[model samples]
Target: MPLLHIENLTHSFGATRALVGIDLKVERGEIVALMGANGAGKSTLVKILSGVLTADGGTIALKERPFAPKTPHEAAGAGIATVHQSTDIVGVPGLTVADALLLHRIAEHRTSLFVSRSGLRREAKALIDAAGFSLPLDRDFGELAAAERQLVAIARALADKADLLILDEPTASLSSEESQRLFDILRRLRAQGIAVLYISHRTADLQAIADRALVMRGGRIVASFSRPIDFSSAIQSMIGRRLDAVRPDARPVGNPVLEIRNGQLAATSVPFDLTVKQGEVVAITGPIGAGKSRLLSAIFGVGRFACGEMFLDGRPYRPRSPAEAIAAGVSMAAEDRHRSSLMPAGWPGHSLAATISLPHLTKWYRKGFLFGNRERREANRAISRFGIKASDPLASVWSLSGGNQQKAVIARWEAEPSRLLLLDEPFQGVDVGARREIVEAIRVRTDRATLIATSDPEEAYEVADRILTIDRHALLPTAADPTTNLAITGT
Candidate 1:
């Protein structure tokens, strides 16, 4: 019998069938990759498995025993652990790495036996060591970097006696090296006969770790690829269509719109020079701390360079704040949408129309009174232009899927004309079809210069006419040929 077996699992929300007749098996000592697009029912299925939802109809067996958990704690008790895309340690670093790792244990034993701080540290240290994770047990959780923060979460999950580990977008924020470290840990877990269900959109992550690949589309398992997987085929199955035979639409590059001379992103970086022409899309690719977002933020006036000069449209541009940047015809979409781009439904100005019209409210006001009709009109226009799948402009932006939400955010910036458009990891959690739509939307208008910051070279290839890398917080020279990078080389 398999370690985990599911037969005809099905679920629905309202009239929408989020999951339909799903069948799968996970064996011990293996890592299985789950591939799907956003809104393809992956999140719904995961929620059911994690005990956050009950399936409408299905059967799941753990070691041949019927299994149904009613809560996350019950799921944990059943030896199933889920680590979400974001590294979340509850009541943690707010509390030392050790405290975060052992919060539940500490809470359970604190009243029975008083343990000193040093004693708690030692216990946590031993647990992480046993799990083969190298972490500073005494350090504050907040001090850890993004990769380290995720590792701490994984270590804690594994130490809690997880038999089957489910990781969602585990390497979303990790560098290549950091991702390798995570892969190593996962390999060790497989050697110890643990079952792992890994979900990711990254080709690199799947190529590196997945022992088997399962593709899901339309709430069903459409395809599966075994070792020596045909990745091209897997991607085609996941997206359910062949990628375009040619580039979407490549426009001619125009005169220089952005110029940076002898600039340093941080005090510890070397000087660099760069230029972006109007009607061109340039992408900056680098690791997490390599200052990809920093470069975009610098241009948007939310971040800075140690010493550098910038010129927009051949005029010196030095924005002191985002308002100044906006006034100068510059707009930017940040990396994390939840914390930055989006607001909950109940909050004022959270609707699709309001979100798109937020920064341009001054233009919507006449005699000190704003017009909702114009806002809704513009919002509907953006939805149509960007191919957003929202039926109502007045609906909350949160009602959209991850991809649509992202489109809405980018639409917010694109609504008003701008000289330079900045996008940071615009395709972070989106899938192929949505990614194509976003690229198409960004390319349709050639009136402005577009600069994108991302860690994925493939994304740069898909979106940018030119690709540059940064190291040590310093902008690197762009290659004479855009396809010089190995990632850009066609296999």
Candidate 2:
């Protein structure tokens, strides 16, 4: 019998049907890849399987026995474990790694109240040893990098003895080497007869790890591919369209919009000089914690550095805050969309137009009242400019598909004219179709400078006119690319 079996699974959120008559099965030790663009019902299906949501109809059988879980705890007890994209935020930031790993046991009173701190550390260390991974039990969970936090979440799942593992974009924030290590671990798990349902937008990951592939669109299983998966066909089926395999040609360049001289990312880092000109998109590539995001943060006026001289449009420039940066003709889209960007649907003034106009509300609303229809007009203009999938500017942004939501965010910054625009990991949690749309939209403008920071080298090449690399907090010249014939220079 299959390890997991689903029949006629259906679910809905208010008026929108999220899942419809879904049928699936996973045999022991099988790895299944779930491919879908945002709002394709992948999250909804995972939620049902993880016990975050109960299916309105259908039946699930695990090990040929009927299974239904009412809560996340119930799901884990039934051998289902999930590592969400943002699993880093699951534990208290102040807790030590050992305590963070033991949080569930403590919550369920599975551990003795009298256990000492050393005991917890020993227990956590043992779990890590048994799982064949390394982690610092005494480190504060908050201080761990994104990759470390993700590993911690995975370790916690293993500790639960879960027979079925669900991973959602597990390598989104990891370096290529780190990603390979994760794949190795998954293979080991499969050898142990654990079934895995892997979710990701990265075709490389799907190819490396998936034994079978399933595409979901509009709340239904649209297509499924077996071994020797036709990835190109699978992607087309996921987005319901063929993508232009070519990167858009670069726009013409002008004088520099942003220039940095004698800039130091860290106190001990190499001093560097950098320039980004109007109509040019420059990407800085690095691993996590390599200080690429730090450069963006400093330019966006959210982070500070010990030494640097910046010039904007041929004038000495320094911004003390984000508002100051915006006023000086600079706009930034942060890496974490849900945390740093986005006015979610339920909040007051959370319409698509409102989200676009939020940062400039002082000039639009002024004090307590909205002045006129200008906000809506700009919102509509952005919507059209980016080919956003939304027809109404007044609708909740959360209702749009995943790719469209990112388009909305990019549009939010693009609505106002700026000399420089910054995007930090702008492609997070988005699929290839949406990514290409954003790349096209971001490059179409020839009047401003665009600086992109990404850890993915392929993504850097796809969107940028030039690519730079950072190592040990030092900005380094990119090796000459034969395809582009560009000599990138830096420190």
Candidate 3:
């Protein structure tokens, strides 16, 4: 019998049906890939399987026995472990690697509080080594790089002896080399009869790791495939359309809009120079920790630049804060939308009306009291322009899918005229269809000079008129083909 079986699984959130009559099965030693666009019910299904959410109607059988877990701890005890996209669930930031690995064991000792620190370290080392990772056991888990944290989370799952593992966007923060190491580990786990349910937007990862593929759209299972999967068809199933490359035609460059010289992110970093022209899109591509994000932060005035001279339209421009930058005709779409951008509790209109005053969609104060008709009108226009899927314009932004939320945040900058636009990792959790829409929107607006930061070469090729790389704080233009020349400053 298969290791896991589900029949007629259905779930809903208020009026929105997240999952509808989903049926699936996974045998031991099999790796299944789940593909879906944002809000396609992938997160809902995973939550039900991980005990984070209770399915309204469904029958699940594990090892030929009925199984239903009411809590995450219950799910873990039932031999089902989940590693979500964010590593926060692994453990608190202050905890050591050993503590993170054996957190459950530590929590289990309710009566006798005395725990053996030496034993925890030894056990944690064994788990890390078994997972083929050499992470420092005594180091604080939060201080490590994103890829290292990902490995520790996987190691923790293995330590739990979970028979069925669910991984959501596991490699989103990992480097290509680290991603390959993880694929190797997953293969070893599969050889040992561990069933893996993998979720990701990266086609390369799906091809490398998954044995079978399942496509979900509009809260339903639309398609499934065996080995040697047809990825194009799978993507089509997810988005309900033929996915096309989002390459934008290069527009005629105008006079320089912004110029920087002798700029250093920090006193110890290398100095660099760059120039951006109106109607031009320049992409900066580099590996993590290579200063891609640091550059954006400095330019957006969130971080200090050690020494630099900046000019906006041939005038001196140095902003001490984001507000100052905004006043000077500059706008930024931050990297981490959940933390650095967006108010989840706010309505969709509040998010899109942030940078510009869409008078029709913005509420003009009446007798020192606020109204929302204009805000609603502005949000609806943005929603229609970006094809954001939502029941109404007044819906809380937190209710939308990851891709749609990203769209709303990005669309906010387009509400007003800006001389320079900055976008960092704009397509992090977005699918092909949404990525195309976002790129097209940015391309169509030829009045502003835009700077994009990404680690993916394909994304750089699709949207960037010129590609640059950051290394040791130095920004240098890459050859026409970014894939062949990945090195930036050779740090």
- Whole-model lDDT values for every prediction: 0.82, 0.84, 0.80
Summarize candidate 3's per-residue lDDT along 1-491 as a digit string, tens digits: 99999999999998899999999999999999999999899988988988989999989998888888889889888889999866756776799988888786768763235657887788788888888777889999767665577788887777677899999888776767778888998998899999999998888999999999999998999999988999999999889988876455645889898898888887888788888889988888888778887787788788878998988989998888888888888888876676556654554434444322322122245465556665667678888899887777767676677788888888777666789999988888787778888888888877889999888878877787778888777786555544333222211
lDDT tens readout by residue for model 1, 197-303: 99988877888899999999989999999988887898899888887624434557899999999888887688888888888888888888888877888888987
- Model 1: colliding residue pairs: none
Q: What is the C-alpha RMSD of each candidate to the true structure, in Å?
A: 3.7, 2.5, 4.0
Q: Is candidate 1 or candidate 3 better by TM-score?
A: 1
**What's each prediction's TM-score?**
0.88, 0.92, 0.87
Could you tell me the TM-score of candidate 3?
0.87
- Compose the digit string of candidate 2's lDDT tens values, residues 298-351: 998988766989999999888899999999999998876655677756997678
Residue pairs clashing, model 2: none
Q: Candidate 1 — which residues are off by over 4 angstroms?
A: 88-99, 103-148, 244-250, 344-346, 349-351, 365-379, 389-399, 478-491
lDDT for residue 62 in candidate 2, whole number 0-100? 87
Top candidate when judged by TM-score against the true structure: 2
- TM-score-wise, the better of 1 and 2 is 2
